[model samples]
Target: MKVYKQAKIVHETLKRLRVRIDWLQRKLIDASHISTLVERMEGIESARVNKGAKSVVIRYDGKPETRLAVLDFLDRLEPTNLPYVQQSNSEEKHFFHASLNGLALAASPFLTPGQRLALAGALVAPTIWEGIDSLFSGSVKVELLDAIAIGVATSRGDAITALSTNFFIHLGELLEAKTNNNSNALLRQLLHPAPTSAWKEQNGELTKVAADQLKLNDVVAVNPGDTIPVDGQVLSGTAQVNESSVTGESVPVNKEAHMRVLSGTIVEEGTLRIRAVKVGDDTTTARISRFIQDSLENKSETQKKAEKKANQRILITLGLGALTFLLTRDFTRVASVFLVDYSCALKLSTPVAMKSTMYKCAKNGILVKGGQVIETFADIDTVVFDKTGTLTHGELDVIEVESVQPQEWPKDRLLALVASIEEHSTHPVANAVVTNAKAHELPHINHSEVNFIVAHGMVSEVNGKRVVIGSRHFLEEHENVDIAPYEELIIRLENKGLILLYTSMDSVLTGVIGLRDQLREDAKSMIDRLYANGVARIAILTGDRARKAHALAEQLGIKEVYADLRPEEKAAIVQQIKDQGRKLAFVGDGVNDAPALVNADVGIAMPQGADLARASADIVLTDDNISGVAEAYEKSRDTMKLIQSNFKWAVGINSGLFVGASMGWTSPVVSSLLHNGTTLGVLARALSGVRER
Candidate 1:
């Protein structure tokens, strides 16, 4: 090994210093030791060492003299005489030997006594060490049980029994580890890194550069079928972008100049030149990935309960085994009682089942943030849906147009005048009017300067006549246009759940346009399914008028409707429902729905929902289908049932074995076989997943 005196500092400030080591590849242990030493020094706040990159960064709050002393101490330090270590496939090797040892003990008659003893001793060493450590630390668990079983058998000079007990314990450990590792591997596949290269605009030309090299305001050129590497606004060009990875929208949205695009969205067609606004870890994809990782680390209440139950059962089993030994005075009987404990299977199978089901849900385009959300989903009794985007399509369609005076203005002419004014606005109602006009092939009319009044109608001059098109309140209250003649018609249209847009030409009321947002095709079926799956109450919360919300709710057979609610009012309704002791779940897809989504027991977001809504939701539907709510609920329920069954089997079988062993009705070999066999069986069922009906 080469030792250096006074390593060169790469960067330094008053409170931090970064240094590079010449050779530290794959030397995690040495790097950890150095980091620990530096961290223990006076006035050093923290030290981080990266063994792979051979670098260290130290954060200190010391004076200049202390900093110099630290540098001098580093220069005088000598390398330890530790062996150069390389990574090894030790787990695989251990599993292989464990299998062979288990086989040898199962066929003990063919092996000599000395070979069996050696195998037993080797197998029990780790368990004994763990048990001793736990005892010294004032905690005892399942490890103590296994250690006692093997130690008692060894003291009785029964080599075959000792080997058999240790063998089964090791086998069970291997199986549990394998199952958990596989589940984690599947969950990790959800987050993938971005591509390596991007076409960057530099010096009036496009050049290929690494994705990580992108900086703010640096324009990047993207082509068809390319993933957007950064979140930015389109400087030029247009495309159909698929934002399913980040926003969970199934359909590709049309993007044009001045429109914003997010990172991880794909360009299905056309090209786009985007200026990088947020790159690398600041992107939406990165945030979701971090959320998922954090969620995985947080366990559910059900898992914690199972763990606690298992720990309590271990203590009871240990006391029972000691009592049995004292009364019977037989080491073999004590060994038998100690061979079985409930902690292993109960702890391993619950999480395995949850994670496996979560992976399946993700594959089906449902992203559940964590197991706790799944548990809460299964418990929800009341399901609340936002009316606009959750129950019906958020897009508006022009259904009908009528001229107030057919003799004065023809229907086509009236529509053309209204559409010409509405085309200048980007509102949803405006888009519907313009779309309907284009479908009817109405010619565009030339108009003077158009003025848009916020939350009111637009005013402009069409062919030397004044034109106004907007809501009835906007026309009557704001523009002072007389709409007294069409009050009956407005009332009828409003009763039919249609939004009306009034038009005035030359200071005379001309016509009214009716627009309606259609209910989703699966809305009724989804509601029925949710009810069938044990949802006690299904309600609608909307910012729409009372008549509109009631009209749509009646169609879907939903009785409870909260209308004209502000964002905070929706959250208040959720809190009221929750206060009644009903577990509630809110499904929404708009920024206004974010408060309610956050207030519910579980929040579900549609794929096409706003980013804020998705972030507030616990579950996100990737296909933007409302029916996924039922699917997620049913899946969570089934996963919980599977967990319960596994828990029952683990406890029932272990208790039975413990009772038989205490009464001296089972031998040590039989006890180990039954206990490990039950654990393996439960694990197999968990990994196999909930059965499909």
Candidate 2:
């Protein structure tokens, strides 16, 4: 096997050399405008043509015998069997050997242009011989052989070319992580903390890890500007980490100690030493990365069924072709049809088109995470969204202020005091109060004995008096404040989708501040377009209450609502949709949406989402608009159509060429030309998507 492989390599090199020299000679003529030389080479007026002296010959049988003789002479100078054979250590000798080797590879009859280029390109590097030797001597050869065999079985059109391309692509993938040259400085920086240990557990579970050390339940300090080295509980400190790459949140959030912190988050501020509860591959980051890698490599159940059917069809066709060829003793004819089936065109076309679309999306400030996600999006029939950060402006605005009597209270003064009490809070209502105070240039009033009622309101003393500012419930339940006449104002604000905050002094409702959450500017238009584009149902899923979800959905023309759901509950809702036989897509931008993104058939996370959410989602919209959801699906569907069209053309043309060859209508040279020409045509069609506006 080694001798045969070596001989074949040598033969191919010489054929490539001849092609290059022939090409260079033509270029020389073009450069100098040598009309007489060209005429002489054509042998127009000569009776006999010189065989080797700047001459050209057109032959019926492709001149294989003549090419073989030239290759035989080159082989005598240096043979693959002889280690480190060299006629001279000069640059010309190296070029001469390389060109000869390329020509020999090209002439092998088994190799195509792509195959020849890939093989010859490898020889230009110094490591080629070492790897080849290693493959021959070590058990690693078995793995390499398996990869090659898989390439052959799974590939269609030009077996050598497919194998060669796969080999180089895989090699590139392997080397990408290790290379740190100047040209790849940015890439190196991005993958510096690359996944080091990826392991599959005995129970068919996979995990990942980056750090060298991890201990059980030890509180690990994940400070600001630091990455979470392991999963742990936030034992101390107040910080908000961006886990968009891992979870997908468009905004950073305030996290206090006692909350569980997953691995792979960028702490924006504050410090929290979390107890290392998960070790090694069990960490969240490792598991997520492993999931992505597995999803990319392992065929989904649907894909497996499709592939099985494709394989059966191909096998049946192969059997029929073989039977026909044996009966007619026409191997060339049989090989032609087998060489150009639609599968190769489909594979290349879909990926190339998808990659191009992804690039286009990036240019437009949208990121479709991967080709696989794009494929899934093309099948979506419904899209669900989160309301607060996703649909609303996420900040409340104080639209109105009212008093018991029309002119009884100074609105600005009342708002100033409310803002003072809520100054230190970060809730939407608190922000609204602060904004109102800022807008009116209200003077600050120092408050003492300030106490926070979680998710209800704030209580404090300002101007040496007790004050209460919060919802109706907070006043009635906590401060025992009465609002007999303020009820009308509160009802009015609620009808407008606003939350009213009542201010009380000494158990009496003094005034009310009406704050409303505004809809996002592009929210309605984007959602409307999505509905027009065949989206049968659209829903809003949020952690907020039912009223909030329903109000946002009503304004955005979304009829469905799933509200007050936790992160895990959101994922369950997505799973329920899938169970109901609906193709569901989720659009979210929070750590809470991570599981939902992973669970949905198609997950479209905002580019601004938390690290975890972005990584979990298959597609990301950088524009942070809901309309991109529809656009992505449209592009994907178009890509799939192009793939199908290219596949049909590739298979159809090859089949016709095979039929022509079988009846002696086409010669070997013509068949070879047609075979490569069809492949080129398919590539051209695939690339046509690039010109799409």
Candidate 3:
């Protein structure tokens, strides 16, 4: 068994060595053109002083056929007397010795066959000869014999030798490992496998459905800590979802049945069984994932154009280098240049930079989902916004209520009654009513049998009295309450973008409470800054009526408005802007704006939005500030610029080295060192982050 184990170890080493030899042989063979130079050039001349003090007759003829003529002369020379050859230059001394050295060494009887073969091959192979030249040529030189020994060590599989040859390879693999594992892990995870979703069989069948099939009402289920797989309505159970990955909100939210959830959100609590109203490809989650994948697969238009130019330039240079090498028979130098020029730098740099920039944005609470989004932000001709909650604080302020029977019920009692009924509802309206009621110090009403109406209002019995609080239409249609006269008050609030709710007791109008969504403190300033940052236009799209949307748009200096838009309509509007040569970025609390979010060049979600929207957006704002958008753009532009610079340096150095090598100005050792240096330099530069403005 021990013998068998030893045999196995030897076999494995042999196999590994075989692989290395194959790789080296392939590369060296590709470089063999350089070795022919020695066979094609020759020195034959005699120039010396005679004792008679007469000018010595020096015969010299340097021509392309000189090497052939010298060979013919050698074949005819007599072997009886001692042969003495003369040379005119020191370079010729080394060149002549190199050619004859192999034959002389091979003729020796003392040296082993392996040693003889190795020495003979070294004399003729440009690679080996160049190694000698490198070590002996300049001030920055090692001994010629030392270089040969090192090259032998490398060829013979010495660990240190392998390390020297593989410096750039190992460094690149290490840096790529670090990058793929840490900062860009998320993007890499999404991109590395090409997604099981995009997998295709040999047959023409598609493996996955497109994303748009997923709908809001679909039943979906995702376990704890898992990303929400699809967008759907929660049918049962409660859990806190960490939407920060999608929406940039660090805080987790409590979500229950009937609440809409999005994809890419992590479930932080109890299991949820959701009803998938949309499935297959149309779902919002699928669309968002599709966008991310597409962004990764497709370069921006500008990048594609740049790559085309770069590729053409590289091809032209390679062609020129090849032609020159063939004409001059300078195979040694040709090999050096070919080894140094790799297309990876130009091909990979920009995409990596863009990916890293996007990650940086995620770190700072902004998530730009795709390359398209980053490019779009760089050219945002117009900006649009939703008024309520987006521009305004989204919090409702309750100042006062005009009671129908002022003497009959105190305002505090009426608000308390309304708040008790609204406690079970989760809408912004409910929160406003509840907060205002608490602030007034009104006695809490013990309410029972509460019922909620989706997108409308709520109802409950307080002290055996039917209390109602909601939209006027909700009360008038459901309870047969007369709300015509209340229209005047509703109109007044509507013009200011405030949603009005009517309160009634047993079908009798008690009073009307006006709820206003206050403006965010930073709304105007953030919008102005976005404008100053080269944003060309700003607009708002919302489900609310035009009057209210327009009112808030005016306040925020927005010039465009689209109100009372269904989710599909909003998406169409976004598409329209995109069609008009403007890159649209939709920022919303994800719940009601999903389609539009997906339609925009970039979907930006706030922490407060539904999980689905966060997942749909490329960028999530952690602090929910609009200014984060601009900051993200700045980082992206800078990172991309660095990527371009890295490519330029990488390609430039390699191309320059190729020229140097071809001219015989560079030796094997120098070329190898340069190749390693250029590659490592490019990677290092790419890793460096952009400076802050």
Model 3 lDDT, residue 28, Cα: 13
In model 3, state the lDDT of residue 211. 27
Tens-digit lDDT string for candidate 3 (214-316): 4445444555754565656787889999866455577898999888775556688888876655453544434444444444555666557556655555555
Best by TM-score: 1
The residue ranges of model 1 lying beyond 4 angstroms of the native Cα positions read 1-112, 115-119, 209-218, 232-262, 267-270, 275-278, 323-329, 406-417, 440-455, 459-467, 477-481, 589-594, 606-612, 659-667, 691-693
Order the candidate numbers by lDDT, best to worst.
Answer: 1, 3, 2
Better candidate number, 1 or 2, judged by lDDT: 1
Q: TM-score-based ranking, best first?
A: 1, 2, 3
- Let me know the TM-score candidate 1 reaches against the reference structure: 0.79
- Against the true structure, what is each candidate's TM-score? 0.79, 0.57, 0.56
Q: Compose the digit string of candidate 1's lDDT tens values, residues 393-475.
A: 88898878889878867888888888888898999999988999999999998999999888887999977888888888887
Which portions of model 2 show Cα errors greater than 4 Å?
Answer: 1-292, 300-340, 347-373, 389-400, 403-408, 426-428, 439-441, 446-456, 460-466, 477-480, 516-522, 563-580, 588-599, 603-628, 663-665, 680-693
664 in model 1: Cα distance from truth in Å? Answer: 5.7
Task: Report the poorest 10 consecutive residues by lDDT, candidate 3.
Answer: 13-22
